[model samples]
Target chain A: MLVDRLNSTARRVPTWIVYAGLSLPAPWLFWQGLTGGLGVEPIKALEHEYGLLALQLLIAGLCVTPLRRFAGVNLLRFRRGLGLMAFFYLCCHLLVWLVLDVQILAQVWADILKRPYITVGMAGFLLLVPLALTSTDRAIRRMGMRWRQLHWLVYPAVLLGGLHFVMLRKGWQLEPLVYLGLVAILLLLRLAPRRKRVAAHA
Target chain B: GTALVGLAGAGEAQEALEPNGWDEITSYCNYYEFGTNKDDPSRYAGQLTTDPWSVTIDGLVERPGEYSFADIIAKMTIEERIYRFRCVEAWSMVVPWNGFELADLLDLAGVTSDARYVAFETAYRPEEMPGLRFPVIDWPYVEGLRLDEALHPLTIMATGIHGRPIPNQNGAPLRLVVPWKYGFKSIKSVVRITLTDKEPPTAWNKANPREYGFYSNVNPTVDHPRWSQASERRIGAGLFARREPTLMFNGYEAEVASLYEGMDLRANF
Candidate 1:
């Protein structure tokens, strides 16, 4: 009975509501950053927070299949919302690093080209560009079967995102390693041999 | 060389205020021997046993033997000094340090006429300092200063902070506090004081010679290859607070600048 409710009326939960709810944190984070709530290094703190939020949403977006398969709860309708929210956070993260942290265009360019961590992070951002562009309903319909294949880009992009976090830090740390581990496990679960891939059709 | 000679006169003195509270001093640190994280020292330095510590005074000194921490403290006259501590990372704090001038200790050791530099070595217990397990830096951290610089009244071997025995996290038993140069030059948890004829290789300079130079004086004009050195963020200042313009020799030029004399700061840096 609960499954029926979730599939029918629950699935009809407005996309605008999800968008507005997720957007609420952006202004709060900006206010904190501007008002001295971010501690000693506010720019660094804000940059880190934004990047982490992006990674968290991306990981959450990847969990839709496992949720449906194991828990018998299909929340596929919110997958696009999660993905768009992740992209929005990623843009904010990159903007803060570029405009606020680095400030100099030459230095920003040098960082992307010279630093291995920045190079990988830029690659992840590049991969997401096409996925975000093709996320619209009209584009998905027009692209048809090709859409699914193109969206597989998210896998490599998410892997790079996790690797970026790990490499950006100075020395070996537990938090970054845990994030990398979660990303790996989620990806491996998707690649595990399954009969017919029911979620692909659904 | 001409420019160096022309700039022989020292800059004017500047005022520096009291340091951040004890909580900030105890919590934040960059002790690579413990770990790279700012809070690692506070979290892990408790494992170090400093009560029974001893410092070996060797090299060109007359007294070349291990002296217990207790004995060293007993022999020295303690005084409180408020000094501005500048880190290479472009952050600063003014801390109240309780210690005697290092010149008094050198006098006690009777430095040999051949001694031109004062080399310092930090404690290296791999088991206690987990960061030592990694090659983050060459173990047993080393730093050095010119003889004149070491003998300066400003150079102190700190025993305590804020009138309390220095916490294990803040280099408990003993540490050098050379207010003019960057923080790393003031080596922490000192275990050895070697009076040497030649300039000693510092831990950071040895690790990355290009980035970290031997005479790491705070010069705002000469920017680090990675970042600007023109300004510094004051610790305990609110996050959004504007970074203050960095001072040459960290505003201690009035006292220490003449020591460099005609030497090129860029080359020596």
Candidate 2:
């Protein structure tokens, strides 16, 4: 019944509208920032805030399937959109860090090598690239069942992301702990049942 | 001097931690978006228009008025003071500041009898400031000190660094430079200075009170919420871990420690 409702809604909502609604927020946020609506130093804040939002979206994208089974919110199809948005923000985040933060090529690569957290963060961000590239309908059809297997990289991407946050923290703090807990619960919910089924069959 | 450093020749440049001195501090910086990094501020923030920037002096003042940055710079003679800036995050830098005494500015403002503390506020335009959205610190960045602390000779409002006007990324136009406290205590891109009877909530302290205290004096004893406050990575120096013994009161023990006499620095810190 929920799927039927979602299908009907999806049919009624034009794809262009969906795309427009999805893509408008970032540029709009950036524009509002340029106009000084956000506060002093709009561009810097816009970039950082969007980057944080992107990380949050990556976690949310991973949670969609688990949420559909557990929380009864079957917004699973939105995962692709959310995932794409995450990659978009990651691109922007990387660009800003490179352009504004590093401002030099030699130091940019040096920072990635020298800082452990940056290394993990870059790993997390880079892992999303293949997933984003193979997200298209044609790519999904071409890869067949392997498409699902390939996309499993999202799990490690999210894991590395949480590790990035933890490693950046010098001491135990509740924020990173919260992200870690959510990831653990997500993995357990998806994998623990499969393990139990295999054991029962044996 | 040994009582401060425990070494007879502690002030003498010693064979060191990571080798290269004057290397990292110039390169790595957390100046947010408004100020230039230690090295790039002069290059990038050079074109910043500070002549039109006005500072509003209000709060517990008998006479409140607006003063342009240029006028303020012209009113007082800037003296060169080489001071150590210890960050709350456990990094330290020895910067030579060209600044005027805060006492001169406070006197010009005619601070009232009720004014017991001086609060500073940064420009809140995110369009210009870009980093305001998620300031590794907080919005409307602030710093303050008790009236006595404000009146201290070492509490100066810096206009330039390294004998030239401060670069944009280094809080161009005007900023506070309190040698006795961690570097964050020196507020940047200031637009407002309010004299208040009650202590103002500072940016770092409001973000994490346990880590950032009201009196962020440089005492080797009080550790930050994350790292050791006893010592710091002197940036632009060789090696990642190279460090030197931190001074008590940031080497301003004689100039400023009397204000906290009989008070436990550990508790106050």
- Clashes (backbone N, CA, C under 3 Å), per candidate, total 0, 24
After superposing candidate 2 on the true structure, give the runs of residues whose Cα lies further than 4 Å from its correct spot: A1-202, B1-27, B33-49, B135-137
Whole-model Cα lDDT of every candidate shown, in order = 0.83, 0.71
Residue B151, model 1: Cα distance from true site in angstroms: 2.6
Predicted model with the maximum lDDT: 1
lDDT of 2 by residue, B165-202 (tens): 67666676788888789888888778999999898999
When summed lDDT is taken over every stretch of 10 residues in candidate 2 chain B, the lowest stretch is B13-22
Q: List the candidate 1 regions with Cα displacement exceeding 4 Å.
A: A1-43, A55-83, A94-133, A143-202, B1-18
Tell me the interface RMSD of every candidate, in Å: 4.1, 13.4
Q: What lDDT score goes with residue A195 in model 1?
A: 60
Candidate closest to the true structure, highest TM-score: 1
Per-residue lDDT of model 1, residues A27-134, tens digit only: 798889777676555676788889999999999999988878766678788899999999999999999888766666886897787667889999999999999999
- DockQ each candidate and list the results: 0.24, 0.04
Candidate 1 lDDT, B152-231, residue by residue in tens: 87789998999999998888888999888988898899999999999998998887787789999999987665446777
